[model samples]
Target: MVARYVVSPRGGRRAYPSIASALRAAAARGRPALIEIAAGRYEESLVAQGDVRLVAADGPGSVVVNQLRGTVLQTYGSVQVDGLVLTNRDTEYDVVSCWQGSLTLDNVEVRTPGGVGTHARPNTRATLRNSVFLHGRTLFTASAGTIERCRFTDAADNAVAIIEGAQVSVRGSRIEGSRIHGVRVCDARAEVVGCELTGTGNAALMADTRAELAVADCVITAVHAEGIMFIEQSRGSVDRARVTDARHGVGAASGADPVVRDSVFTACRDTGINVQTDARGRFEDCRVVGARNIGVFSTKGGAPEVHGCHISGGNVGVAITEGARGRFTRIRIEDLTTTALRIFDPDSTGVFEDVRVDRCPAGLEVRGNGGTTAEVTRAEFHDFDQAAVALAGQCRVTLTGVTADRGMLGLGIGEEAQLRAFDCRVTRVSSGGAVVFGSARLIAKNLTVSGSEALGICGRNSALLDITHGEFTDCALVGAAFDDECTGRLVDCSVGGTGDMAVRHNGLVDLASLTTSLPVVRNREPVPLPPTIINVINIINQKIITGPTIHGDAINNNFAWGNDHVIQNQPTEEGPRT
Candidate 1:
């Protein structure tokens, strides 16, 4: 049986006069011992060993131990401290410390004046439950620990800091009014679950410098900087978090890649979620509401994959720029003041599939020169202002099953770019519909432009427009206009229904089986076709490119635009010239 020693300032009935004498007696007796103290204040520096249990006889808040020069209690054995107030008056000392032992604090309050509240060193194991800390950080250095149901307030620095390969788990803790980050984990692994962090001066939760973090069901609010950030090669996962009124809701930079899922960010001042500077983060099933700046910004080697997310009420919805690569699938962009999505990198494929953008000022933009082909599939744009869909900067863009409605312009390709559209439709266009200019090439198949107030399709400035099986209806001025060294070809195309002219041709244009209302057909004679040319267009728009040594795919023989296909030597209506 373990011996019990009673300690009281007023000595009576075989009780020790001071806690120090009681601890000396327990240590001399050896084995496991219990030191119960009466209601009093003891001024002493103590070292508890040999499986000691320090309990307050009159319960918590009754026993106060103030160490004036050093730690209040340093434990070397398995020590259990219950219902005691531990305080250190010196700034250079800690209230409670465990260096190479197991320590448990239950129902304890640590009040330190300019000192650490609780410290567990590299070889220690600490567990704190139902505790309170004030004006100091609960630090763990290369230690293994768990903090449960603890409250930390008015912290001088981070409320909890875990560093140097520490493995810690904090559950059901509230860290509020921290001067710096609420919780910082560097070069360690931390799992924080069911925690609430409020009013932090810096990032609410930060995992930096190769640390790993997994946070779930947490609330972070009123942060001066990022709510949750991971930087410097750190990777983590966040689930079901709510971040409100932060500068940036979530940020990943400098090789950090965090997969955040099912989170909501509200009223962020800057970008709601930012992945930049070689960071590759994935966001899935998240909602960003009322962001003042861009909703999602990825740039500078940042490659992010966002899936099944909704972004609403931001200045710009999503901006991917400066060699960044972004792939968005099943995303909803709603009611932004600026463009919905912009992709400026030349090497980015900009894969966007099953996206809906409503009431944005502009739609998707793919810009830059010598770019790989960007593929967008099943994208819908509604009520956009100038560019419902615009492709510029000599880039290559491919649109399949895309639709635009009730916009100022629907689908424009300019700036020497090349566009290949398949099964696309634009309706209720107010200003213009399907315009191509500036030495560009637009190869459209199964395209429909209906209910347009101005020109249905206009081509200019050496533009090559290949339209096959297209329907242009309800156009005002002209259905299809080609001019200024434009090479235009239309096969099985119809132009009618409330248009002034069916076809206005001022360039080198050839038409076959064109059904129109009033066709002013010029250059109707059959012209000999040119040779199979693999020239600038092939160089600008090709996935598997060919050079002088590597003979490319012949344009007319193998690849052709619909019925204008040419076989090697098959003689048809248009004789083979190859």
Candidate 2:
């Protein structure tokens, strides 16, 4: 008893002039049927199966289902098209064609000239509320659906295409001029909420096989590519997204594992979060500004986990190379033009904590062509012009409580590098306070070089220094400098207010229990007591009760042999002795 039909192409009373004779008298009243249609052009081609509505007495732009050749509405079991205006002057077919039923378009208005503007076949299930798909190419391919408050403009390709066992839910959507992807999930499962995608030629949200996308609070702007692109083994999560002018404002590669939170990637031409091949992503509290290149890029063997991130103007403010591996925490890299964390793969390994590098010229730049390893804790390097921790090839680093301020060079262990510093601190370094050359190896503990204007620890070729409990204060020059053929071991060391010389051996230095209030030991070229100097410690300018002689061929039976057994030469007392 519920079958109402009223067509009216301007006829008399109980009108039924067009709408295919009121859908053939409401399909002979077999069950559910509405069919209203009254106010304008209707060069129709409608076909319905069971429960059909097709109502638009005088609403959506006053009814206009202008079809030329194929589909202008061809549903199967349950269809409902309110306030109609579905077009198609034959650009190649679809203008609403839901094959196996369940199609609902509320305030509908699909004007297709270049084809598909709603074609949900293959287990069809579509629903678009307050819809509007204008100059289309691909405006829908939903298998299971819900596109609320929809509006897709010049869509030439994918403007919501969720194939392969789909499960779509696009909320409060708005995709403008999409020449390519503006939401395209293949193996399918999408949930794009509060969407707003603008002028996308490619990747303004794209997920491939094994798909699982969940974009929240989105606003993807002018994207030519990658404003969210998770490939192959897709898995996505982008929250609080902004993503401006994109090339890569979120791009997870083949082995995709995307989880970008609190996102804000501005003017990105390239890497503003790009995890490569063996992908593993997790970027939290994100904020990557003007990224022209790397503002978080994990390469081939990708493994990213950046927390509390804030990378600014990037050329390289986090670029873990080819064999990528990363785990940075509390990171804050500033105005970078180059090198503010670049760990080139040797076998790639990075673990940074509490990092903060300001005005970067170079802060934490480890290059490894074969063996790389990094582990920095509590890092803070300021105003770097170069060398605020820069290792070369075959790198291996470990710095705890690291701090290098006003750097020109504060920690630059060259090729063949291997550094292990604990409680490190190099302040006001305009030049050097930790510089080991090729064949580098520096092992320091509790090292503190204060106000360095130059050399407060500088080793040359064959460099290798093992310092334990060090302190060199107010150094303007030499307070520990070993030249070519370098080799060292300075234990319980201390040199204060050094402006000229305080331990400047040519090479092979082994000083134990050394204490200098300030002055000389500039033995530039005379260290021929080789036998590896079993023990030779007497470099005191101040308080030394006695304990400095046990040279090769061991002879220390209680220090009482002064008959040429050499254990007594304590009379070179100079000024400034503490």
Candidate 3:
């Protein structure tokens, strides 16, 4: 029962002056038609087929559809464009061109200086409410769509270009000043809710081939490059997103797999979430701030799973290289300028849990070409200037319940690195608390080194240090130090306030049971069987032999009489060699 036609340029009275004679008198009254256009410039180029209703009596700046070149409204079956103002001064074509149509645009305003602004063609179905698409190159190609309260301004390339098997739903949208891509899905399926993409040149949401994107509560700002770009086998899901100043904030490569939840990436110049080649990404409760480079970056064989993340002021906070693999949980890396967790190639693998590194220069940097494996659990390295866990070449690390405070070399095992520390705690370190050099291998068990100024466990060149149950107190110089062609084994060790020396060897050191309250053995070169001094406690002017040949039983040594404690082959009686 829809048939009402009234069009007027000036002379009214059952009007019908222009509007192509009221669409040929509503297609000779064939069926449903309501063409009520009044008030102004209608230099028209309109074409509709069966059911049409183009109503704009006084609203939409008083009706103007001035297509000076090609298409300005061309529908097929069912169309309803109410309160219109479509321009299209034509650099070539489209400004609203639906084909096998069911188009509905209420309060529409599509002003194009160059081309496409709403061209829903292949298996068409479009619906835009309270719309505005200005200065368009491509603003909405929408194969099947629903864009509510939209405003896509100054779009030169793509502001919503959902392709092939399209399913688009964008609510409360505002894509602003987009030169390249602000939402461009290929084998499409896009659902962006409460979106606000600002000043995007390249990628503010660009999902390629096998696209399926769902971005909720989005606010992507100043994106010069990737702020959400999922390539080849594209798959995306970003919730509560806030990406700012992006180069790469969520960029998944070839085999893309993206699931980023509760995201917040700010001031990103390079990578705040970049999973490469064999991509697998899943981040929950994420936040990466002020990233100049690498706040979560996995390379070639990428495997990323970061949960409860917070990385701040980054240079490299979480960077797993070439043959990448990463799995982090409860990570908190703060003020990182150099390395807070950087596991370089060599078939890389990193598994961290409850990691916390603060003010980093280098906190957990495992690099050595190709056999990198870092497995950390409950780690906390604070105020690191250099090495709070730095294993160089042939890296294989395993740390459980690790803690290094005020660090400057707390666990720095160099080339051929292999470290296994369990229940480790190194406090107030300046230079050394666990430093094994060249052919590095350190296997510690309940190691605790207090206020260390220099050597509390330090092994050199051919290093392989193994401490079972070690504890060193206020060590300013030496509590366990092995030299050049080093090799060590301190089973049940304990050293007190060592300002000078307590167990210092040259090459091969094996102390089964060593407990020194002050001085036990400090040999620079000579060593056969020194440190077996079990609980030697007589600290007056402590100097317990500068050369090592002191074998096991120093018989509960307690010498403090004008102390000249030098027990060298004391079997003259059973008094000192007990």
Candidate 4:
């Protein structure tokens, strides 16, 4: 048999005067119970050890249960509360706690001044729907639960906290004006979908300490910290999310990797996506716009695999620095105030393929020690005010099938940088097409430097050049110029439509071919020279039917110091986020 009880403050209509008295009677009866409270204020605390449903006789907000210091309600068995207001001004306890069994709250309002509004402990499940939590956080400590259509506002702590290996699913929730994080997961996991988190003092969503948080169709805005932060080896994924006006749209560090897909980050103060300290996040099909500093920043063992992304209106597009290795493919970077892609410092290598950079001052800049290396293939640099591709410091880079159009300078290699360009085209550059200085080395094979406003190829300041089958045409100035103690072998190269001299050598340039070759622009790679042939006869006497001679042991020994990979990057996974 079931028992029913109605309670009021003054025992109206022969009902119990207090909720505790009725609960005591219901417990004495020892049966499944339903307790209906009248429409009035109740200054009380109640504990239910058995199954019970506590509801207001009237609609929601008609019954106000307020506790001054301690928990207002604590349940050990399955409990359901509906159409009631639970308020507590406790400083050291949860207002409503489910300790042993499940709790279902529907159309309930909880307001706690200094304690948790609701706490679901381990081995418990909390089902909250259409509830309002104000000035308190809902804690799921080592528990499992689902929250649907809930509102959390003005939380003193995180709006919702999932910790201690708990797992929760939150859907269609709105969290606003949180003093701390909107949602924080530590050593736990959560899946938040169709949620809006705004006005958070800290990160809107934080996954730390091996926590995994999956968010989809979410909007996070007005965050003082990062919109989404992953740290301490956390794993997570964000899909179809929009983040705006955060310090960093997404920040990952301490071995945390967040797989971000189909997301948009706009007007972030710092970098759009920041990965550091061994975090290897994969960002795909994302758009980062109006970032103040950089669009994508990966450094210090952070190797992000970014592809199919568009970045614009940032100071710099992407920066991979300080032992970070990244694989960037099909990335379009445009309209930046500074460089498009910057690879700097030691032990950092970037392999860029099918990348396009436009309207940036410096397109692709590589500056580091020999530990820094880059392999760029089929890159397009357009409308850059400065050099399209610039290499400085002591690094090595290889550019193959790269096209630079309408740039001030095409390729600028300086300061002990070694660059190898094969089947590359530099057209409509205002300055020189390929400029090598400051003890740099260039092994240019089958390159076309045409329609340059100035000289085609300029080598100066003790630079080394090994050019083979380089075709220069329609240059306003000289075709090729080597001055100031530059020494190299130019073999099987042609120059045409130069307003000045075809080939000008001002200093001691060891040219193997004084007589220019025919203007036959062969559509093929330059052949490697045999080492035995270069060792016996002088380079000048040999007809040299070949390309850049670096493959041959005779010439490879001259510039072999910058060819080693000091640091190898680990693999980056683009599979579905866990």
Candidate of highest TM-score: 4
Error of 4 at 259 (Å): 1.2
The parts of candidate 4 lying over 4 Å away from their true place are: 510-578
1-578: candidate 2 lDDT, tens digit per residue: 56888887888689887886677667767688888878888787887778878888878769887877788878888889898888987777888888886889999889876657887777778888987888774444437888898888877777778878688799988998878888889887989998899888998889998799999998988889888989898997989999898988988888889888998999899878988888888989999998998888888888989999999886788878778798999999998876788787567878999999899877887767556789999999898766687777677889999998986667877657789999989888766678776687899998998888766887766778999989988877666767667777888888778466566665366767767765544433322221211121110101010235333454432221011111111111254455
Please write out the lDDT profile of model 1 over residues 1-578, one tens digit for every residue: 88999998988898999887887888888879988999999898888887889999999879998877888888888899998988887778788889778899988999876558899999788999998998888989999999999999988888899999998999999999889988999999999999999899999999999999998999989888999999999989999999999999999999999999999999999989999999989999999998898888888888889999899998888877777778899989999987787777566557889999999977877777666457889999999866677777678888999999988667777767889989998888775567776787899998888888776777766788999998999877667766556777888888768776566665366667677655443333321111211222222233111223114343544321212222111112332122
Displacement of residue 166 (Cα, Å) in model 1 is 1.4
Tell me each candidate's TM-score: 0.86, 0.45, 0.45, 0.88
State the local distance difference test value for candidate 2.
0.78
Task: Point out the higher-scoring one by TM-score: 1 or 2.
Answer: 1
In candidate 3, where is summed lDDT lowest over 10 consecutive residues? Answer: 535-544
Which whole-number lDDT from 0 to 100 does residue 229 have in model 2?
88
Q: Rate the local accuracy (lDDT) of all candidates.
A: 0.80, 0.78, 0.78, 0.83
Better of 1 and 3 by TM-score: 1
In model 3, the clashing pairs are 346-370, 555-578
Q: Name the lDDT value of residue 165 in candidate 2.
A: 66
Pairs in steric clash, model 4: none
Consecutive 10-residue window with the lowest summed lDDT within model 2: 536-545
